[model samples]
Target: MTQVVFYILPQSLDNEPEDVSAHFIQACAIAAFYYGQSNKVFIFTDNQQDAFSVDEYLWQFDGDSFVPHNLLGEGPRYGTPVEISWQPPTHPRQILINLSSNVPKFAINFQQIIDFVPASETLKIAARTRYSTYKKMGLTLSTHAVTNDNAVESTKKAED
Candidate 1:
């Protein structure tokens, strides 16, 4: 069964209410941490702009954390350690960092999924729909709370 993990952001980043950059940062951190463990990661964005944003941010997310990644159609045929795309990954990956509004139909192809529940109420509602959909799929699901202070480390901090 696929395992789904949700990282709930406690607050918006940079004091911008409901800012999405926080989600992107956390997703990058998680992808980098998993890549260190030899996991193939795919970041599924909502659109081309978001995919490009993540591709750019992943490069400078941290001075010490380096995640070799490329935007879909720009990377190697099989892709790098991490791949950002507005579409589903062509090949199955070990982990998926979903930054979309709804769960994609190809989500079950991955062994694990990393999703986010933003600080905004409107976003949370959309997240809940995804949560319910996953629950109905009978997948193993878990959630963790992340704060701006620990967002980077929180990826590696998941217990069990």
Candidate 2:
């Protein structure tokens, strides 16, 4: 069964017009965590702009640790260990970091899925639908209350 993890943020920046939201930043952090685990990851975005936003952020996410990634087709044929794209990945990834509004149908292919729930009322409402969908699939579902104070540590140190 696939494991689904929802990271609940302390604040809601889901409606931000720019890509500078905490939600997006946390996604990159989580992606880096998985990359450090030697797990191939696919970061699914809501649009082409979001895909680029993540690809750019990963470049400067951590000054010390680097997560080599590319935007889908622009990278090597099979791509790097981490890939960012608005469309489905051409190859299977061990983990799916979903930054999209609705879950992708191909979500079942991944061994694990990471999602975020901002502290906004609107996003919370939408989260319920996603929760139910995953539950119905009989997937192992869990949630983590994420605060800036403990965000980076739980993901494990990149240098470790």
Candidate 3:
């Protein structure tokens, strides 16, 4: 099994603590839906004192159709504490999706950081479209399509 892990970083114009949490949770839900469509098991890990709050919020979105395992830290120091100053709460939020032997077709296309942040309605739709595209390609939800050599060559030419 291969596990693809994505970490969500909060983006807020203001330093309001509440906004940070809200954005992080939204990103988590978006990521869960995308991964869930591939029939992958999704796990959420966070360091918030009220991780359950975020979990409950995500559970409210029914259309997502992804049941995620919530892993919360009791406090900043749970099992082992790392030394870092000014640790952003969002940095610790992560979504781990486990795939079978095959890699999903859309994995490479959607791996860009922008796909998982600020979860918006447009982004949700795009994610669904990508998921459906993979299904129609006769590829298993966990199967990744081999990259075309020509596409690689084109990219290399553009860089040069």
Candidate 4:
């Protein structure tokens, strides 16, 4: 069964548009660090710009730390631990970190799926819909409300 995790960000919906990318990058980096390079991760975005921005952010996410990643078509398909893509991944059962607005049809194929619920009412409503869809599918689900106070500690723990 797929494990779905919803991470609610500390930022309010008013600031969601501005800080969503940062939140997404931070969450992805932590997951990459925790899962390590052996486990492949796909960070899905809705557009080329978002994909490229995520690719760049992953590179500079941690000043002293790094996550091995590449844009979907930039390099060899298999070796890179993380892939930033606007399309579906070629591999099945990999970790999926979704930054898109809608639920992906291919989401059921992933071993794990992580998504964010921004503080914005509109985004949160969409996230709730996604959560309901996953629940209807009978997937194992979990939620973490991320706050500024615990964000650093959570990242640190994932690093370890």
For model 2, residues 50-100, the per-residue Cα lDDT tens digits are: 898888888877888899999999879999989999999999899999888
lDDT of 4: 0.73
Q: Best-fitting candidate, measured by TM-score? A: 1
lDDT of each: 0.86, 0.83, 0.33, 0.73
Which runs in model 2 stand beyond 4 Å of their true positions? 12-19, 156-160
Error of 3 at 108 (Å): 17
The reply for model 1, stretches above 4 Å from the true place, is 14-20
- Give candidates' CA RMSD values in order: 2.1, 3.5, 15.8, 3.5
lDDT of 4 by residue, 1-160 (tens): 8888777776632223354454575556555655564667888888889888787666666667677778876677563778878898776537888888888888999988888887777888999999999899999988776676666355443223
What is the total number of backbone clashes in candidate 2?
0
List TM-score per model, in order: 0.92, 0.90, 0.29, 0.84
lDDT of 3: 0.33
Please name the candidate that would achieve the greatest lDDT relative to the true structure.
1
Off by over 4 Å in 3: 1-22, 41-50, 62-160
Show the colliding residue pairs in model 3.
102-142, 103-142, 103-143, 103-144
Q: Is candidate 1 or candidate 4 better by lDDT?
A: 1
